[model samples]
Target: MKLIFEKSVPGRCCALLPACDVPVRPLESRFARKDPPRLPELSEVDLSRHYTALAGRVHGVNDGFYPLGSCTMKYNPALHEELAALPGFAGVHPLQPQHTVQGCLEVLARAEALLCEVTGMEQMTFQPAAGAHGELTGLLLIKAYHRDRGDAARTKIIVPDSAHGTNPASASMAGFEVVNIPSAPDGCVDLEALRAAVGPDTAGLMLTNPNTLGLFDRNILQITRIVHEAGGLNYYDGANLNAVMGVARPGDMGFDVVHLNLHKTFSTPHGGGGPGSGAVGAGALLAPFLPAPRAAAAGGGYAFETPPKSIGTVKAFYGNFLVVVRALAYILTLGGDGLSEASENAVLNANYLKALLAPYAPPACAGVCMHEFVVTLERLKKETGVTALDVAKAMLDCGIHPPTMYFPLIVHEALMFEPTETESKETLDWAAAQITGILRRAAEDPQSLHAAPCTTPVGRPDEVAAARAPKLRYRFDTL
Candidate 1:
């Protein structure tokens, strides 16, 4: 494809402006430019066609099956986009008087209510911008709660070894020392190790139920009880909440604080550092420390009200109101029953793939998984010297996005797959078949696996050079 600038005509214009009506200052006195700005000069038709072609080259959930594990790239309803784009919802200003934007506040309030109902929490604060940001905010709330109760010495947070990296990073950012507890052979938190880790200095334990390996911690109730007995809180990282949405509630599990990724669980468009909403919910104990200004009933309408001791503003305004609107639409579309069915289907699809791939590459543990599953390529690596990276590259040639590789940091040759609820049974079967074929091919012809993605617009580059000497901006000279 030609660069847009390369198609530029010297004097072409997309629009014609009328003569300036206001008195204008002399150019020498008012402006400091020696030459006019250089911009693309293409016809409207030319510009439209160029962008349309570019959009077609991109891959998304709408394009095909996206089985990127731990990322839950599920299909979003088109109604969400249509509803979020409505002028009344999208055109409102954050600083508008509360009375003027009652409808917007009502939408936010309803979102909070729905989140509270879904997660089984007392209150929610839609202040964090993303999942990590929500983690930070939730940790800060924990810090404040401890300090207020005169437990300043409780400054240690325990995280499992298989947890997402953000858990420890967020804990560290909140001024707590992070202690990693290893998972047992069964892929769940080691109860004995956890008991040893918890003490007077422990403030909380951050955990995901169906951990990154997609194995549910069956002892979650006992784990929460142990933490509480030690005078510590349990923080639920809702990254994998899609696995247990309607089946379980964090609050019922004795979690004091939780953060839900609206994009992942509620079907919102999220990628490339987002346009995401991560609403933090709190049990009654932590409710008083939620971020301000929380939505409250005022007269006959909703309005913002700050708690007595909040964590202050995590975002400039109500965080990502449009994203919240989209989430609300999704919730309304998928009532409680539909959401449960989605979770069940997600688990069913994952287990189906697990069964198909077990003979080829089984997980570290046994039994059924939750919403996603991980398979290792250790045998293929030992026999053919072809690694999981080679298999991932080979997937692109088969016209499918690769599953997440080398993740969870638990398995050696991990290929994490999450066929979300949106995928069909045929799609799941085809994906498993392709993966099996790739492994078989790798055994026969290892070199083909190493040199893969032969059918992309551009082949792979030298990864080291691409990272260290990145060409972020276009250069006319290079063209």
Candidate 2:
């Protein structure tokens, strides 16, 4: 394949425009550039075919089964896209007067309300743009809530060993000491250890129910109780909320702060960086510290209100408003019962796949899982010299995107899979069969797995060289 620029022909145009009808002013001499900009030139057909071919080569949830763990890469409903693209919704400006954009404001309010009802929180701030940003916003709220009460001494946040790396990083950015509590052998947080770790210095605990291991913390009630007993707040990392949506409420479980990844559990697109929304919800205790301006009802309509003691604008103009619109569309489409069914089916698919792969996996503590599960390849590595990386590469050959490998850090040779709710049983079975077949082949000819992914456009580059000599920016000199 050649670079798009390499195929460019001089003076070729993809589009034609009529002469300007309106009177135009001359450019300011100071603002004018001395040289013309370098750009690719191609015919309309050339440009169209090039991009269309590129699109075909990329795989997405719409293209196939994406069982990538932690990241909920599920099929986004096409209706949401259509709704988001509507001119009435899409043309509205963020800085437009409140009266001019009441419908858009109402969508944000409704989305916030739906999230509050689903998570059992009092109010929500849809200002955070991504999951990590949401964590920072939640932590800031915790800090503000404590500081407003003159409890500035609360400066430490307790995170678990198996937590997403963002948890600790967010805490650190908020000027809190991050204390890590280890997970027990059974993969739940070490209750006794957490109890000992908490004290007056503890600001809060960041936890994910149905943790990264895809195992729900059986001691959740007790865990929250322990944190609250020490006068510290509980922050729910709602990344895995899909496993327990209507069945459980983080606020009811004693979580003081929560952030829901709308793109994950709520049927929006994921991956490729994003246009993502991570709405932060808070219980009554933390509500006053939410970011402003919060959407409110006024004069038979909606308006923005900055609370007296708000953390103050975590994002510009109520975060990504378009993503919020998509989430609102999703919530309205699913309602309550449909959302519950999604959670149920997500758990069912995960457990079914776990059962299918159990015999081939490295030793795991016996039990039922939630929406995702980890299967270690330690034994396979020891027996056949093949590794988790090899298996992931082999999965590509079978036309399936690989599960996240070597994550959660605790599990050796981990292959974490989250099939999500949308995949059919036939697809799950095929994935399982492919994984099993790869393992069997590994036992016989380990070398074959070394040179895997022969079908892809590029196979097995020298990763270190690629990284060390990254071609980050385009250069005409190089061309």
How does each model score on TM-score? 0.94, 0.96
Put down candidate 1 lDDT per residue, 171-268, tens digits, no spaces. 99999999999988656889999999999999999999888889888899999999999999999999999998789999998899999999999899
**lDDT values, one for every candidate:** 0.89, 0.89
Off by over 4 Å in 1: 1-13, 16-43, 271-273, 475-479
lDDT of 2 by residue, 220-327 (tens): 999999999999999999999999888899988889899988889887887467878889999999888899988987899999988778999887888988788888
Which 10 consecutive residues of model 2 have the lowest summed lDDT? 359-368
Tell me the lDDT of model 2 at 299. Answer: 91
lDDT of the structure predicted as candidate 1: 0.89
Cα RMSD for candidate 2? Answer: 1.6
RMSD of each: 2.4, 1.6
Q: For each predicted model, how many residue pairs clash, with residues at least 3 apart or on different chains?
A: 0, 0
Ten contiguous residues with the weakest lDDT in model 1:
24-33
